[model samples]
Target: MDIHRFFPPHEGISLSDLSGLCGAELADPSQVDRKVTGIGSLSQAGEGEVTFAVSAKNLPDLAKCRAAAVFVTEKMAEHVPSDVAALIVAAPQSAFARAAAILVPDALKPLSFTSDTGISGAATIDPSARLEDGVVVEANAVIAAGVEIGAGSVIAAGAAIGPGTRIGRDCHIGHAATVQHALLGNNVVIHPGARIGQDGFGYVPGPRGLEKVPQIGRVIIQDQVEIGSGTTIDRGALDDTVIGEGTKIDNLVQIAHNVRIGRHCVIVAQVGIAGSATLGNGVMIGGAAGINGHVTIGDGAQIAALSGVAGDVPPGVRWGGQPARPMRGFLQDAAAANARAFGKKERKRGGED
Candidate 1:
């Protein structure tokens, strides 16, 4: 795949210079002058691109890689082809990530709907709203009364900022997105069509029928967070719903009331985190995973795709399947069940014969 479609390469850097930026050591000093033009995966990388291999299993694939340079660990150095330059690092993936940031800084910036730097004439900014210098409010966007937006933030076209909402510097509220009863930190990016701080599903069974419970808590989004398009983060019922710094949430994810996500968590598309669920730092929830309410996922835990998590997950473990047991245990149980089924089928066929 051509990475240029998502992040265009603007400038080329020598392998030596790139190594310095990413804390990688050049395997061969002679190849330091090799020019890297873009970044891609090991399978897709070609000439002038840089890629990385994180494990020994990936080392064999290096022979097929056509990249100008690759980031690898010391143990995998021997498998690197002679023609491909090797940049040794303790963590190949992390080094490649750093290199990408350095080479394509613009890729990190949020998409802007307009080039205009000030409030558009078509926008509806209340008289009581306070916008700092360099704040951009696009056409038809609504800034409610008592809203305070910091400098360099962009409220995109047709977006709505609720009354008393506080947005920090360099934030981007995408087109048609709505944010209410929220406090957003610097460099936060809320993508187009995202709905934040809406009332959660809260009700009590009363004598008459179901009684609605008031949702009065706010949503607090910390610095450098990116909430994806069409994602819904409901407001807390009592305490605040908090999204920690540097968390990247994919499109169509649902974060219910009082969900507390920790720093640098990766929540993939269609993941549903129920109310009061707490995810620890560096936790990764795979696509379509369901996290039950009040569950605590420990730091660095990984939930496999489509898994149903019904209880607390321990730190740094991989879990999968219904109820989300340890991956190894789940795999063992599946294999045993398969073997039993196969044996039973053979026995029944022999008896019929």
Candidate 2:
């Protein structure tokens, strides 16, 4: 595993430097100089590789890892063998994530743009706006200033892009997918009729029934983010709604203001995330799941379909039911209720308890 493949030569960071930069206490500095070809899970890592032990449960597998270096937490450092080099860090997962970036190849260049192509003349484009080859901006597509588009990305008719909306190469913005005053990373697919950066659901109860509030914030969508059809992501009342990298939002999902969705989160169809709700990384929200305002769903949490989440969810837990509860608890409750109903029916028929 020559380290050159993992870390870009342009980055100027060698495997030897990773130890110091990540606050890792190396077991064998000699191995630190060894080149790493790739990154993988502890169970699958090969020689000249680097992997991370994210939790105590993974320590047993880490012991037998064939990789040159293993990122382990302070608590698990004692378990790491002296023979295998260890990159001891407080947060092994974070360190491993940083290492993965060094290994993965950068995005490829955009396709070539043909001189004679369909482009909206009425569109206001900045000098820095990167229009890739074969990219089409339909009639009345408002490409605002400083918008950079990757190759083969298409903007449909009447679609609007706010300032600094960076669309990745090869992505598509569907018909009338309105994005304003926001920042978007690469490989983002925004479906038709999706309204991004709209006003949030905010109203003050005054002498009248309700008074509307002004929404003045923006949305920040990271790389590889996909927004489905008819989904509406509202701008913050005062702040912003940020969708982390690699998050996939399904069709007809409603995301309110100031919502912070972590990386790799999956939001299924018809899911409604209320204002100020925060979801941690790797959270999976099922179809028709309704998250109440101000809820905090921890990392790796799973919300079942049609569940109404009103409270904070702990990390690595699965929840379900109308008012969301632990999946096991919800199942047990349903079983017990059915049993009680059966017992009542037996008693009514003159059977003994």
Candidate 3:
């Protein structure tokens, strides 16, 4: 992450003030006045930088860490180097995050590209469209008929909002992105080049050939959902495809029609979900995973990278493999296969001897 891109250079703050803000207790009172200018990782932090150590894995590097201040849990306090000031907290990473937000307010806020004119004159907007106060439409964007955009939303340059789409407040339709047949909630972000509410891949075998199924359902996205660049979400065939609140989907992900993803799900890049798949709350899908159609992944289930989930996954389990099974079972099978291969090689070597 480039710190300069997300945050401006912050004026140094006193260790005493920073510790108080993060609800962490300073280990050495004499170092309270030490100045902290920036934040960095344990390996990269230098003088005047504040870093964090969350577990024992980081303890080995504490002796070499050159940061002026460090955040640590109570148990890790003993490992802190004498020269470095330790700020103890219940959760080191969480406390460090809070400190970053305080020091860099711009990092938490949305990007602003507001021009002299509130709405761009070059943009093409239908007369019937309703745009609320503080909505900014950039150059060459199109707002189709019957579209309603809420307050503080931004339609970036070259973006297109299809007819009858309802967008809520504080939403951002990124540059060159397209949205159609969708109802979006507040605080939603559709990144650049994202394709939303497109027709699903539905077909029927007929006498003429493959018959196309008309997809008329909407894509309903709840609040705080962030769709990554180049991602495509197909509109449902009959029922709405719903993405619950706070779900973070990575780039190049393909979500098929009628797929319902629950709240707070983390879907990594290149993940493809087939139609009618249901994922319960807090589910995590690793990169390049394929979820079969009509399957249900229970709450808190974790799908490993490159996994092919062909059946329903139980709640609170870790699954992996081409045909995903329990993590433990998958590991055992791999170990057995490796052993058999090694034995066969040894027998061939003995026969040659």
Candidate 4:
């Protein structure tokens, strides 16, 4: 797909300048004059563009690469086409990412939907609401009473801010997202359609049937957190639902009330973290995983995709499967199941031979 319509290529940068910007060692400083204006994948990169390769698997693409330069590891540098300048780095992809950020800075964050700066006139802001300088409230956005928005924050079109919520500096509240009973820290990015501070699933047996529990707690989102589009984070039952600094939550994730996620935790798409569950620092929960309520996952634990975590997990362990056992035990069960299913076929083949 042509992305130029949305994210245009940069003007130009010389090879030496790009190397320093991306922390890469230029193999041949003489080629410093070479300029690149765009970035693409190995196979698709053309003249005056940049790309990267990390392993021998990319050799076929690297052989025919037409980019002005290529980020590569020391081992892969030799295989790069002679026409392309090689930029060596320990982490080639990360170097390329830094280059992308430098070249396509706009792609890092969402641009103003209405293009109007400093509070659009069409936005409806309460008289009591406090907006600092450089806050951009786009068309049809609603700011409730007592809302406090810091400088350099953008409230996109149709987004709603509830009463008394505080948004910190440099935050982006995307189109149509709703924030209520929450306090957000600096550099938070709430993508389009994300539902924050909604009531959680809590009920109790009553005389009539089930009685709904009043969700009155707030959501505390720390700095540099990016919540994906369509994710829903429920308000706490009694305590604040806290998302730590730099935690990334993917699309369609359901974070229930009172959940505490530690710094830098990554919760992938469709993951459901039940109420009051606590995740320690650097924990990575894979796509579609279901972490049970009240369970504590230790620091650096990795839960595989489609796993059902019902109990506490120790630090730095990898787990997978239903009821989520240690990876080794899960693999053993899989191996036994495989043997059972294939044993009859093996016996039949032996008789035929």
Query: Candidate order by lDDT, highest to lowest?
Result: 4, 1, 3, 2
Candidate 2 lDDT tens digits, 56-168: 78877977878767888778877776665788888888888777766654422222222224586865566667787777887667787788787767787667887777777
Model 4 lDDT per residue over 1-353, tens place: 77556878889999899999898998888899998888889998888889999888899999999888999999999998888999999999999999989878898887768888877899999999999999999999999999999999999999999999999999999999999999999999999999999899999999999999999999999999999999999999999999999999999999999999999999999999999999999999999999999999999999999999999999999999999999999999989999988998899999999
TM-score of each: 0.89, 0.61, 0.91, 0.96
lDDT (0 to 1) per candidate: 0.93, 0.81, 0.93, 0.94
- Any idea what lDDT model 3 has? 0.93
Per candidate, the number of residue pairs that clash is: 0, 7, 0, 0
In candidate 3, how many clashes are counted? 0
Worst window of 10 by summed lDDT in candidate 3: 108-117
Please report the candidate that would top lDDT against the real structure.
4
**Measured by TM-score, how close is model 4 to the native structure?**
0.96
Ranking by TM-score: 4, 3, 1, 2
- In TM-score terms, candidate 3 sits at 0.91
Model 3, span 1-353: residue lDDT tens: 76456566569999999999999999999999999978889988888888899998998888788999999998999889899999999999999998888766665544544462468998999999999999999988999999999998999888999999999999989888999999999999998889999999999999999999999999999999999999999999999999999999999999999999999999999999999999999999999999999999999999999999999999999999989999999989989999999999999999999
Candidate 4: Cα lDDT at 277: 97
Candidate 2 RMSD computed on C-alpha atoms after optimal superposition onto the true structure: 9.5
